[model samples]
Target: MAEEEAVKLFGTWRSPFSRRVEIALKLKGVDFKYYEEDLTNKSHLLLKYNPVHKKIPVLVHNEKPIVESLVILEYIDETWKEGFPILPKDPCQRSHARFWARFLDEKCLPAIEEACLRSVDREKAVEEACELLKLLENELKDNKFFGGETIGLVDIVASVISCWLKAFQQVAGVELLTKEKLPKLCEWSDEFVSHAVIKGCLPPSDKLLASLRAHFETVASKELCT
Candidate 1:
């Protein structure tokens, strides 16, 4: 693709969904322009492109918009299918990859979001969060990555969990994915984040922690004063 024909990604720094697309682009060695969107006041282009959900992490290829992080991931893979494959070539392995990716979306992502955003029952939320982490720990026990030895589709999806989990731990004042509790999963996270592409795409840990602290405090104060 020529310089003008290159892709353009609309996203936010803190959004893990956006980060997924960013990492995929870097992994595939695709040239693209990044446009960060402010969720508070979303840009006209974002609204115009994704009018339905009006969400970030929209990828524009040749000016055609693709929404949803996972959907965009599949699109990226298919578009540059020749390069480093994110999804496996074998039919069974590809199905397994999709299963885990969907699992992260259906189960893991929601649990983390609830733990971070909902404050009606703080203790219950933290407990539920730990349960989800335990399930992940079991799934990751023997596998180096969700796709086995190398990082793949499911690995990318699961990687988002760490960022949110870290935020939750800071806000709730509890450590769930510790060395002693979920050793392998914790180790996997350490290795996953160490990848140059993923590491460069992630937001600063301190900044994410501070944002989570402020968000939880705001939610907690509002609930108490109400």
Candidate 2:
């Protein structure tokens, strides 16, 4: 395939979904072009490739576009099989990984967002977030990573918590994830971010904090105006 036609990723820096795809590609040693999208004024190509949602982290390979980060991760893994595997070879283990990844999206993320944004029921949001984190903490149960001894699909999917959640909590004045509350998960976060591939993918800490702070404040002001 021609270099330009091989692989291209449309993504934004602040999006964990985007970063997960980048990390998966790097893990598989796939060389690709990255187009950073201006979400506020999304590019024509982004919309054309992902018109259904128009969200980023789209992976276009050989003229075929793969939307949704989880699906993109699996595509990158299946297409590039020369390197470390992202999903487990065993069907049962692979299903387990997919289950937790879904829980992170469908259950955990919403609660965390509610708590961070300080919505109408702040205390309930925080409690639900903590409960979900505890379940993840139990799941970890002494594994080095969610993938067991190496970064896998779950770790990549949970990168938002490892790299972005603490900063978001600090900016929003919420502390749902803490050493005191969930020690094993906290340790996993440290290991996940400190991993060489993940470290390279993360935005700088100060920059992420500033951006999250500004985003939260803007949301708060808008709520007050309403």
Candidate 3:
């Protein structure tokens, strides 16, 4: 008889990166034990598994650990091979998806975070963010999702913008993603979050908002002390 494959995930609820791993695992229909790590006092298992980065969203499969959310997402897609595909099968489409996913992480997310959270030179930050978002808006033109009719790699990577951005904007009193400014992106966000797989995986909006509010307050207090 074959031995059962053991799967475990170390993550935190408030982290979008952590949420990304959960979404991928659930999407691929992989059953995994979840260990919620305290960011302030990280677990020993987390440290042991991810010695280098010491980050959350570490996926352990049959004792082999995978770090980095994007890497884990790809790993999950490749390993499972039973559920709906995460990345497109065609080489060209796969490359395009990878490019956009990287863009979401490296370019769009940072710009949006700065625009929503910046305490200095707010105008310039918002302007830059808006410009970047316009590019995304154009990319999403007329498609129900970045993955056309269904959710895919780009949508998964951009989940932070769809869900976390709302809390960020509320806490910072900034409205970076709006229906008026970027209608297509706004619509995409709405539809993205509404999906059955995504809706359950995301943190509750009210709880998330309160947490961000407390976090920003703590940061402000520390800055004032400094």
- How are the candidates ranked when ordered by lDDT, highest leading? 2, 3, 1
Question: Which candidate model has the greater lDDT, 2 or 3?
Answer: 2
Can you give the TM-score per candidate against the true fold?
0.91, 0.96, 0.95
Against the true structure, candidate 2 reaches a TM-score of: 0.96
Per-candidate total of colliding backbone pairs: 0, 0, 0
Kindly indicate the candidate among 1 and 3 with the higher TM-score: 3
Top TM-score prediction, candidate number = 2
Q: Rate the local accuracy (lDDT) of all candidates.
A: 0.82, 0.90, 0.88
Question: Considering summed lDDT, which 10 consecutive residues are worst modelled in model 1?
Answer: 114-123
TM-score computed on alpha carbons, candidate 3:
0.95
Error of 1 at 31 (Å): 1.0
What pairs collide in candidate 2? none
TM-score winner between 1 and 2, please give it. Answer: 2
Rank list by TM-score: 2, 3, 1
Clashes of 1: 0
Error of 2 at 158 (Å): 0.7
Predicted structure 1, TM vs. truth: 0.91
